[model samples]
Target: MFDLICLGHAALDRVYSIAAFPPEPTKLRATQAMEVGGGMAATAAVAAARLGGRVAFWGRVGDDAAGAAVRDGLVAEGIDVRGLRTCQGAVTSTSAVIVDAAGERMIVTHLGEGLDDDPAGLPWPMLAQARAVLVDVRWPAGSLALLRAARAAGVPGVLDVEMMAGAALAELLDATDHAVFSRPGLAEFAPGLPEPDGLAKARAAGAAVPGVTQGEHGYLWLDPAGRARRQPAFAVRAVDTTGAGDAFHGAYALGVARGLEVADCARQGAGAAALKCTRPGTRAGLPDGAALSAFLAERAAAV
Candidate 1:
């Protein structure tokens, strides 16, 4: 049985390191470059696997080299990829990520075309073996379908609210037990509202836990008791921040599977996110179980 199942987007990322984003649309020199697997749920699956959770990735990819890279990358990270479907003739999603000296990154993505969006053929029975399910906004149909099924199966569903239309957000929120929004996603959900107020809106819509990931600043959430809580980000010299949020969500889902309290789970997430920032690239920066444990232990000792 898998400890967590990640369902949604997956892609290959071509990353470049540069001193800064060019102010003008002009030629610039890259300090470094590499290719790696990315996408929200896909990276999260890698994070959970690195943290020693039995994780599985469920999503669709094209039958192409990019798709193969996505599959092989996850497999190398010890994630189960049996559910990663290959759609014939479709092009797998891909992204160009450029990271600057401060570790901030700008990404341009091509979602690709001719891909199947239907979740009907997905293995619904697998919910029985999963302790928790994580979904992203990239695939509304698949995310909603899996979220509903996970809810019915009594498996926790964590929504990576990266970005979505208002209607889709509302529908997914109702079925989501834990709705963790990206900074932009929270603003889109509750425009002009404060973080606490925005998350409150998510709570009103039936999400038991509504949170946002604040890079460097850390995580903020409304707990089950209606109390607003915070998990300050661990101090790290960031080399890249590309997949930090994904790492947080993955670790948080694993914590939920382990029956941790919401606050503790956020700490787990924060630790993972901090560690992820210490290196370049997406999956390359993820910390393993031992690393995460040691990081958390040191933090505890300092406290």
Candidate 2:
């Protein structure tokens, strides 16, 4: 049985490392560049697989060279891609990421028609074997469908609330057991609430639990009992922060599948993200089972 099933878009990411944001109308040479598989759900699947979870990914790609590259990357990471679909007239989703020396990034994405395809075509029986299902906002309709099915199957459903519109945001949260919001995304959902207060508001809106991830500042989570807690970010020199959040989600899902407490899950996620930032690229820097175990052990001793 799979520990987790991740459903959303899969993309080929072209990352450019620069010292700073380019001046308006001015061109700056990239200090470094790399291409790899990326997308909230896709990257999370790879992270889970790397951490020794039995994972599967359901997403849509195009019939193009980029699509092949993405599919190959996931398979190499040990993520089952039997459920991945290929779209006919569309190009695979793509992203151009610009990272500053400080490890901060600005990304421009083209989601393409990846979001329009139905995820119900996925192997339902196989998906049902998963302990939990994770989805991103990139594919609204498919993600909603998967969440409903997971709920009916009594499996946990997690929503990675990335960039989304208002109504879509509400609908996504309503279908999720846990809602983890990006900072800007949470502000747009609850304009007046302060950062910590926003987590409470999101939880009250229907999510069993709500959390906001503040990079480097740590994460603030409101548990199912209405108690809120903040976990400080682990100290590390971030070389590239591109996949940190994805690593967090994957490790958090692993914790959930293993029946770890919510607070413990958040801590594990934080630890994984911190380790991811110590290296370069998204998939390249992800920790394997042994590495994560050692890191977590050291973290426990430090605490």
Candidate 3:
């Protein structure tokens, strides 16, 4: 039985570390260039596996070299991807990430046609074995299917809300058990409100635990009983922020599967996200179970 199943968005990333974000639109040298496996559900699955969760990734990639690398990278991390589909005539999702000296990034993405392919053929029985299922906004159809199955199977569903809107976003917010938002995600769906109010709006729609991941500001959530809480972010010198959020989602899924409280889950996720930022590549610095334990312990010692 898997501890978690991640069922949306898979991409291969081409990252270039530059001296600065914009060089006046002129030619500039990259301090480092590398190709890595990325995408919301894909990287989250990697992080969950790294942190000792028995995880699987179910998503689509093109039948190309980049696709092979993306799948192989997940296997290297010990995630089950027997459900990863290869689509013909459809290109894999790809991203070009530019990281500046301050570790912030500008990401330009090309979302291929394959991400929206039908999810009817996915193995629904897998949800019965999972303790939790996590999804991102990239593939709402797949997310819906898996989330429904998760619900029927008595598993918690965690939604990683990004920049999705309209009926799709509304339906997902209602379906998810734990709705975690990117700051922009909350703004996109519940616009013109403060963060707490936006999350309260989402909670009113039936999401049990509505929250937002506020980068350096930490993780914020409205508890099941309508009480607001915050988990302070860990201090770290980031080398790249590209995959930090992905790491957070994956680890938070693990925490939920293990039945941790919402705030404690945020603490666990924050530690994992902080560790991912210490390295250059997307998945290279993701912490394992031992590493995560040590990181949390160190924070306790400091406190």
Candidate 4:
């Protein structure tokens, strides 16, 4: 049985590093360029695998070279791709990621149209074997299927709430056991509501545990006692901030599978995210279990 199953969004990313963002309309040069594996759930799968979970990725990719790379990259990270499918005559999802000197990035993507949106034929039996199911908003159909299955089987359903329409977010939140949002997502979901109030809103909407990740500011969530809790982000020299949130979600899923308290899970998540920022590529800085523990230990001591 797998520790976790991630069931949405996988892509090949072409990354370019430039000195600054918003370059002139004229031609310019990138300081560095590289190709890497990306997409929300895919990167999270890599993070979970790196953190010692027996993780699996169940996503659709186009039958192309980019698809091959995405599969190979996950295998290199020790992730199980048995459930991943290659769609015939479809282009794999691909992204152009541009990083500036601040380690911040902007991505432009063509979400290839070849992926099948219907998740009714997915391997429900295999999902039943996993301890937890973590999903992204990219594939609403697949996410709903997996989330429902996990809920029915008493497995945790961790939702990565990024940019999505209100209707979609509400539907997913209702089925979500642990709803984690990005800062922008929270703002969009509960516009004008204060952070704590917004988290409360999500919880009231049926999410058992609601939280938000605020980049370097830290992570904020409402505890079971309905109290607001915050975990400060770890300080590090960030080389790229591309996949930090994905890393956080992956670590948090593993933490849940490992039976950690919510607070401890957030800490583990923040640690993984901070470490992810220290490297250039999206997956390059994902920490293993030992490294994560050591980093948490040192930070705890310093605090």
**Lowest lDDT block of 10, candidate 1:** 162-171
Per-residue error for 102 in candidate 1, Å, reads: 1.1
In candidate 2, stretches whose alpha carbon ends up further than 4 angstroms from where it belongs are 114-116
TM-score of each: 0.98, 0.96, 0.97, 0.97
The alpha-carbon RMSD values of the candidates against the true structure, listed in the order shown, are 1.0, 1.5, 1.2, 1.3
Over 4 Å off, model 4: none
- Once fitted onto the true fold, the runs of candidate 1 whose alpha carbons sit more than 4 angstroms away are none
Return the lDDT, model 4, position 10: 95
Ranking, TM-score, top scorer first: 1, 3, 4, 2
CA shift at 24, candidate 1, in angstroms?
1.8
Q: Considering only N, C-alpha and C atoms within 3 Å, which residue pairs clash in candidate 4?
A: none
Q: Model 3 Cα displacement at 80 (Å)?
A: 0.9
Per residue, candidate 3 scores C-alpha lDDT tens digits across 162-279 of 8754467878888889998999889997889999999999998878899999999999999867889999999999989899999999999999999898777899999999999999
Encode model 4's per-residue lDDT on 13-53: one tens digit a residue.
Answer: 99999888764576659999999999999999999999999
Q: Is 3 or 4 the stronger prediction by lDDT?
A: 4
Which pairs of residues collide in model 2?
A: none
Highest lDDT scorer: 1
Report the C-alpha lDDT of model 2 over 101-127, residue by residue, as the tens digit.
988888899886633466667788886
Q: How does model 3 fare in lDDT?
A: 0.89
